[model samples]
Target: MRISFSEWTKSGSPWVWLNAGAVAISIIMVVGLLALIAVRGLGHFWPADVIQADYEENGRQRTIIGELVEREMVPAPQLRGAGIEVPEGVEAMARDLIKVGNRDFGSADFIWAMDHFITHTQRPAMLFAAERLEWGNFYGYLREVKEAGQSVGRHTGYEKTQEYLTLWAEFQQRIDRVLDIREQILSIEKKDIGSINYEIERLRLKERSLDLEQSTDTAAYAKIEARRSELNAEYEQLQQRLTDLYQQINRDTFVAEIADGREVEIAVAKIVRAFLPNDMGLAAKIIHYAEKVWEFLSDEPREANTEGGIFPAIFGTVMMVILMSVLVTPFGVIAAVYLREYAKQGFITRLIRIAVNNLAGVPSIVYGVFGLGFFVYFLGGHIDDLFFPEAKPSPTFGTGGLMWASITLALLTVPVVIVATEEGLARIPRAVREGSLALGATKFETLWKVVLPMASPAMMTGVILAIARAAGEVAPLMLVGVVKLAPSLPLDTNYPYLHLDQKFMHLGFHIYDVGFQSPNVEAARPLVYATALLLVVVIALLNFSAIAIRNHLREKYKALEM
Candidate 1:
C-alpha cells in the first residue's frame, strides 16, 4: 500500500520506528562493551604457552622468553621516529609485545620486539611460568631444586625419568608446605597479634582519659599496667613464632635458567604458582583457570593492586552503599512527606522544591568538597573534641573515612529519594486519603497505613537509582574516604567491630588505580577491565535486590491502587 509521508507522520509510524531503532542500538552498544570487557578480563587468568625466542638488536643477539601479549602492525615511520631502524619504503612493521616476567632482573616487565629481527621461536613444554609474590611473572626452565643451600635433584624436562618425576613431587610437596605455613603466619599476625595491639591501644586510651580527668585512681592505673604486661608477653611469643615461620618458609630454593642463560636462585616460598602451560591438559588448564579467578576474587591485592584479588574493594563498595541507603531513606522520606502533604502550598515551599531538584544536578565533586569541609573538618572536629579528647592531636573523626564517605553520598543522593517519594505521594488518588478519613481514620493514620505503604515501591525505586550512581562514583569517595590501599578492614573482630572512622577501598577507585596509576601499564590493563566488570556485577546485584523488594511491594499493593 502506497502511503504519503504526511500520512505516515500523522500515524506516528516514523517516530515509533526511529525510537525503536535508537533503543536497539543502545542495547547492542552496551552488550558489546560488556562482552569486550569480559573477554579481556577473564582471559587474563588462562595460562598461555611461554615462548622462547632469539632476537638481534643493536649488533647483539640475546634469547627473549615471555608470553606473547599482543601483535600489531606499526607504521614504519613511527618506529623510525622512536629510534628503531626500520627498513626504508616499508609502510608497516610487525611488532609484538612480550611479557618477560623476571622483573627484578629485566629493566622492564614487558618489551616490544620486531618480528623481522626475531628468529627461532618455540613453545617448549618444559618452559614454566612462575607467578611470584614480589615480581609479576618469571619465565624460565627449572634447572634444579635445592634445600638448605644444597642440591636435592636436577630437572629433566619432558623425559619423564623416574628420578625427575620424584623431584617434581618433592617440589610440589614443599610448595604445599610453604603455602600452609604462609596461612598460619597470616592468621597469627592479623588475628592474634592484632587483637593484642588493639587491647593495648585501648588501655593506653583509658589511662589517658584518667589523666585528663586528674582522677586519683591508682587501682585503675594498676589494672591498665597489668593488661599491658600481659599483651607484651603474648606479643613477644607471637614475634618469636613468626621469626621461626619465616626461617622455615625461606629454607627451600630453586634455580631456574632464564632466556639469557643466567640461572637465578629463587626461594620456593616466593612462588604464587608455577605452571607449564604447554604441558597442561584441558582439565588441568580449567582447574588452574578457576584457581586464578578465585584468587583474583578472594585474595588481598599486592604489587600496587595489579597482581592480586580485590576482596577489600568489593566489600568496601557494598558496605558504603548499604550505609548510604540507611542514612538517606529516613531523611528523604520525612522531608518529602512534610513538603508534599503537610506544608501549605506557598512560594517558600515551591522554592525549596526547586532547590532540591537543582541539587540533584550538581556536580558530584562539589558535594565531595562540601563534605570535606562540613563533615570532616567542622562537624567531625567538634565531635573529636567533645568525645575523643584523650586521643588529642591525632584527628580521629576529623578525617576522611567510611562514616564521612557514606554520609556524603547519602546527602548527594537524598534529592533523588525526595523527588521520587513526592511523586509517589502525588500519584495516590485524592479519594484514597478521603476514603481513609471517612472511615474515622485520623490524617496521620491514613498516611501511615495507606499512603506510605503504596509509596514503598517508589522509595525503593529511588534507592535503586541511588545505588547505581553511588557504586560507580570515584571522585567524591576519594576526597571522603576511599584509598589506594587500606591496611585493615573497617569491620573486624575488634572491640567495636564496625570502625566508622577507618578508610576503605572501593572497586571504582581500584579500577582508576590499576588503569592510570600503575607502573606496569600492560600488566594492569587486564585488571582494569576485570575490576570494571566486577563493579558492574556488584551494582547489578544491589539493584536486583532493591528491584525484588520493589516488585514484591507492587504485587502486595496492586489491589490498593485499584
Candidate 2:
C-alpha cells in the first residue's frame, strides 16, 4: 500500500489501467457511431408534420408549404454572401431547411429560410403530402376528384364533409384500384411474359446452334417458328389486357391546389400514397412507419436509388458471400491439411506460408483487377467458347457477374482460412494422432474423423472473419459483379435457377451509389446510413450463425482436448 510511484510502474498496474482506458474509449466510440447511424436511418420513416408558412423575402411575403427538416446558425458574413439581408446588429442568423416537396414547380424540393424572416408557420390539418411514382413528393390540398374528366367529389371543409363522401375518400379508392392493377401489370410483365421472353431467347440460341453445326434441321426450325408464333399470339393477348388496365388506371385524376394557389391535375395512377401527417393518430402513424420500413426492406429502388427498397442488394450480398464460402472452404481446408499434416517442413514450405500471410494484406482492389482479367476474360471466355458457342458476340460468363465476383472473393479470403486451419491442425497433440493410428485407423481416417472435426471451430472462425471482410467490400465488387442497378436479380425462376452469369446489386455498392452517385443528396443521405446499418446487421447475423456452429463444435471436442 505504501509502494513508491516507480515501484507502482514496475508492478504493471499502470499499464493495465492504460489498456483498460483505451478499450473503454474504443467501445464508447463504436457504440456512439452505431447509435448515430440508427437514429438517422430509422427517423426517415416517421410521419413529420408538414407546416404551412409565410416568409418575408425582399419585402414580399410568399407562401411556403413543407416539413421542417433542419435548423442551423449561419454567420452574418455567410448570410450576406448569399445576398440575404441580415439585420445590422446580428453577427449570425438562424436558418431552417424546409422540405418543400414540389419538384414539379421547377425549383429545388428543399429551400432554406431565415428564422427571423419566417412569419407565420402552422401545421395545416388539410395539407396532404402525396408520394408519387415520378415527381418525388407533392404537398398540397386536395381540391377535387375527377373520373373521365367529370367531377366526382370535391373537398368540402373537414367538418362539413362526411367521412365516406369526401374527395380524399374517392382519391383513396381510386388509388387503391390503381395500385391493384399496377401489381397485376408487374406480375404479368416480370413473371409470365418474362418466362416467355426467356424461352424465346433460348429458342434463338438453339436455332443459332443448329446453323453453326451446319445441320439441316428443318423440323427443328419449323418447331421453333411454331413456338414463336404461339408466344406472339399470347403476347398480343396480354398486350391488349395491359392496354385496357393502363387506361382504367389513368382514367381517375385529382386536382390539388398548391401553396401558390395553382391547381395541378394529377393522374391517380401516378400516386403511390398520400397522407395528412397532422391528422394521423399515434396508432396510424406507427402503422404508416412500419409500412414504410417494410417497403424499404422489400421493394426495388427507384429514383436513381434515392427512393424505395434494397431487397436486391441484400439478396446479392448474401448470395455472393454464401457462394464464396462454399468455394473457399474445401480448397482452403485441403491446402491447409496438406501443409500441416503431409508436407515436409522446409524452406519452401515456410516461403509458401509467408506468401499466404502476405496475400491477406494485399489490397482488395488488386484481387478485383486480377479476377476481372483472369476469371472473367481468361477462364470465362474459354468456358463460353466451349459451352456457349451459339451465344456468340454476347458475353455470358465472359463478363463481370455473380460467379466471377464470388470466385474473386473466395480467392481473396482463402489465405485466412488456410492459416486458421493449419494453426488448428498444429494444435492437435502428437499423442492423439499416434493414438488414432495405433488403433488401426488409416492416416486419412484419423485426420477426417478426429483432427478435422476438432479443427471445425477454427475453420468456422476463419469463415466468419472472411464474411465480415467480404460483405462490406465495394471496390472489388464494382470491378467484378456489383452494379448501380441490376435489371433482374441473379436468382430467378428460369431454367438455371441461379444465374451466376448475371450482374447483381450489393449493399456495399448500394451505399456508395446512393451516398455519392445520387442526383439528390438531401434525399439520399438517410438511405446511405440506413443501408450501411443494414449491411452491418447482415454481416453480424452471418458471423453469429458461424459462431454458433463454432461454439457447438468446440463443446463437442472439449473432452477430446482434455
Candidate 3:
C-alpha cells in the first residue's frame, strides 16, 4: 500500500490492470448494446395475442381489435399538453400503443389510447392478422371464402374454425399459383423480351455504324429486319400469355369482417399471410416465428420497406464489400511496398506518408462528394461514351453504380492497408532480408518469396479493418450507389452476370430509410433495430474470417519472426 509511484510503474502490474479494465468495459458495452438491439429487433417476429378491447374516447365507445404493441407511462404534463385531462394530483398517465391494423378501413394502422379508458378487453382466439400486399396488416374476423363475389364457405362463428382453415388453405394455393404466374410474366418481360430488344438495338447500332462507314449493305439490312419481325411476333405471344395469367390470378377472393362489422372482399392473391395468433399453441407459435424470420431474410421488401424482407440489401452489401476488398488490396500493397522497400527514405516519402495518414482522418462524406464528381461523372461518363455508346442519353456507367461505389470505398479504406503494410514491411528483421539476398535471390524475388508472405498477416489485419468500415458505411454509399429499393439484383443470368453498372441496395441505407425516412415510423422502428443487428453480425463474421486467416499466417511464420 505504501509502494512508491515509480516502483508501481516499474512493476507494470498497474498498467496491465488498467489495460484489462479498459478491454473489459469495452466488451461489456458492446455486449449490452448488441443485447438491446437483439431484444427490440428479434421480438418483432413473435406472434402476439390480438385483443378486442372496448375503448371509450371523447365520450364515444367503440370496439378496437388489434395487437397490443407496447405500453408506456407518460408525464401528466405531457398528456395535458396533448389535450388529455389527467386527474388531480396525478403525476403520470399510462398509455398503450396498439396496432389496430385495419389500414384499408381506417386511416391509420397504429393508435395511442389511455389504459384506463380501455375496458372489456378480450383476446379473441379466432381473430386473424393478415399481412397484405398493399395496406399494412389487417386484423379481422374471417367471414368466408368467396369466388367472383359469391360466398363459398360456411359462416360458422369462431368455434367451428375447420371450415375457415380449409378456406385459408385453398386461398394459399391460389396465392402460390398467382405468384408463379407473376414470376413467369417477370421472366418474359425482363429477360426474354429484354434479350430480344437488346439484340435488336445491337443490330440497329451496327447498321448505323455501317452507314457511317458508307458500307451499308441491302442483305444485312434485310437480315436485321427479319430478326426484328421474329422478336415482335414472340413479344406478341408473351403479351397474350401475360394477359391470360393476370385474368387467372384475379379470380379468387376472400371476405374478411372488420371490427366495425364491415365485410371487405380481399383478393386471395393480395394476401401475403393470414395467421390466427391467439389460437396457436407453443409449437405453432415457434414455427410461425421461424417462418417470419425466414421471410424477413429471404424476401424482397415491399410497402415502403415496412413489410417483407431485405434480401436485396443484404446481397448488395456483401457484393459491394467484396468488390471493395478486391480493388483495394493490390493498390494498397503496391504503394506500401514501393514506399517502404524501394523508395528512398526522403522528405518526399515522409510527406506522402503524412498525406495518406491525413486521408484516413478525412470526413467520409468528402470522399463521397469526390467520388460523385471524379468517379461517377468524369471516369464513368468516359466509360459510357467509349464502351456503351448505344445506351447514351440514359447513363450506363455515367451514374452512381456498383463499380464506382466499390472504388470509392476502396479509396476511402486504402490508407489503412498502406499504413499496416508499411509497418509490417518495416518489422521484417534485417537479417531475414540479408539471408534471402545471400541465397542469390534478386530484391524482387526476395520480396515475393519471403517479405510479402511474412507480412501477409498484417495485410489481412488491414483488410479486416477496411471491411468492417466499408460494410457499415451509409453516407458515401447513398451518394454513390445505394438506393431505397433496387428493382433487381446486380448479379443476374444476363450477358454480364455481375452488372457493375447497376445500382444496388445496402443494409446500412436500408436501416436509415426504415428508421427515419419511412412513412410509418412506428411500424419501421423494430425493423431498424433488426437490420442494425444483422449488419453488426455480418460485419463481425467478415472480420472474424479475416482474423482467422491472419492468425493462420502468423502461426505459420512464427519461427521466422523469432
Candidate 4:
C-alpha cells in the first residue's frame, strides 16, 4: 500500500476545496437572506404614488390624473357645463367640482374630499394620496370643511359666489396684515419677548401686592396700583395682538372645501393603473400583506387587530432581557467562583457539571411548561397569597407575564453563564490567586479583586449568548408574557406603573398571529414576513451590543493578562 506523494496531495486537495466551497455557500446564503430582508423593510418606508380610481354614476370609469381640488372650483355650473348632472343634496357642488378638476391640491384638501365622498356614498372609496397625508383622514378632511362652510347657507352658484367674494377679500386683507405682524415678531429679538413676559409677571405680582395694601395705606396703594394698571394694559395688548396674529394665520391656511369622491377615484385609479401590474406574484402578495399590517397598525385601536402597536412587545422584550441578565450574572459568577476557587475536583463537581450541560440541552418549550407549573403556580402563587390576597386565585405576581418570563429565561440561561464563567475563572493563572493569598488577602478578596476582573470578558460572552437566545425565544414566552394584543404599554402613566403582570405582544408572536392565527391569513402573510424580519433584526442588534461590550471588557483585561 505504497502511495506516491503527488497522489496523496491530490486526494487531500479536493477535500480542502470542498470544505471551502461549503463555507462560501453558507456565508452567501445567510448574507443574501439578510440583504433581502433589509431591502424589503427599508422599501416599506419609501413613499409611493397614490392611485385613485373614479367610477361615474353610469358605471363608466375615469381616471383622475391630477391632485385633489375643492368642490368650489369644480362648481355645479362648471360640472353641468362639462356634461355631468348635479345630484340633489350635493351640499358643496362647487367645492367637489374643484377637487375633481385640480390635481395639484394639498394632502389636507385631498383627504377631506375623499372622506366627504365616502360619507355621502356610504361606499368604500379609495384615496391614493401619500400616506403622510397630514390631518388624520377623519378630522383633517371633513371637520375643517364642515366648520368653514357653515357660514354660507345652502345655495347654488350665484348666491354662493357673492358670499365667497365678500369673505375672500376681507380674509385676504386680514391675512396680509397678519403676515406683516409675524415678520415684525420674528425680527424682534428673543430678548424682547423674554423681557416683556418678565415685566408682565412682575406687574401681576405688584398688582396683587397693591390689592392687599389697598385698605392699609391709601397713598402707597395708589402709586403701586397705577404702576400695575399700566403694566396690565401693556400685557393685555401684547396678548391680544399675538392671539389675533395666530387666528389670522389659521384662517389663511384653512382649507374650506374638498374634492368629490369621483375625483379621488379618478386620481387613485390613474396612479394604480400606471404602477400596479396585471399579474401579481409571491413578492407582490407579500407586499400587499405588509400594507395591510401597516394599515392595521396605523388605524385607530380596534378589537380586530388586538395588538395595538409593536411598542409593548418591544418594551417587554427589553425588560425581560435586562431582568434575566441581572438575575443570572451574579448567581453564575458566584457559582463559577466556588467551583473554580474552593470546590475540589471530585464526583460532586463532575456530577454538577454534567447536570449543567444536560440542562442546556433540554427543549426550551419544556422549560416553558416547567416555569408555568413551578414558578407561576407553585412558588409565585404562594408569594401572591401572602402579599396580594386581594387578587386571590390569580395573584398579579404569579400571573403569566413579563416577570415570570424573565425568571424562566434566567433559569434557562444560567448554565450558559456558569459554564463560561467557570472556563474564564480557570484561565486566570494560579500564580495570581496564590500571590494574592500570600499577601494576606482573603479568599473572597483574591477571587473578587484579582480573579473576577480577568473572567469578566468570558462572563460577558456568556451573557451575550444568553441574550441572543432569549430575545428570539417564542416558546418560553408563549406561556409567560406574550399576548396577541395589549391595550396599553407595560409601563404607563398609572399608579404603580411598570406593570410586569400584563401580557404583551412580541415580534415572534406577531409572526405567529399573522401567519396562523389571524382571521385573514391571506391579508397577514406579508405582515408575518415583515415581523419575522424585524425579530431577526432585533436579535442581531442585541447580539451586536453584547459583542461590543465583550470586546471592550476583553481589551481592558488583556493588559492585565500581559
Q: How many residue pairs clash in each candidate?
A: 0, 0, 0, 25
Query: Could you tell me the lDDT of residue 80 within candidate 2?
Result: 91
lDDT of 1 by residue, 18-114 (tens): 9999999999999999999999999999998889888998788999999999999999879888988987689998999999989998899999999
Runs with alpha carbons beyond 4 Å of true place in candidate 2: 156-165
Sliding window of 10 residues with minimal summed lDDT for model 1: 156-165
Off by over 4 Å in 4: 1-19, 50-309, 493-495
Q: lDDT tens digits, residues 190-216, model 4?
A: 334444554655555555555644656
- Whole-model lDDT per candidate: 0.92, 0.91, 0.89, 0.60
Better of 2 and 3 by lDDT: 2
lDDT of 2: 0.91
What is residue 472's positional error in candidate 4, in angstroms?
A: 0.4
Query: Candidate 3 residues 353-388, lDDT tens each?
Result: 999999999988999999999999999999978876
Deviation (Å) of 97 in candidate 3: 0.4
**Model 2 misses residue 60 by how many Å?**
2.2
Query: Would you give me the overall lDDT of model 4?
Result: 0.60
Candidate 2 differs from the real structure by a C-alpha RMSD in angstroms, to one decimal, of: 1.4
- Please give the RMSD to the true structure for each candidate, in Å: 1.4, 1.4, 2.3, 16.0
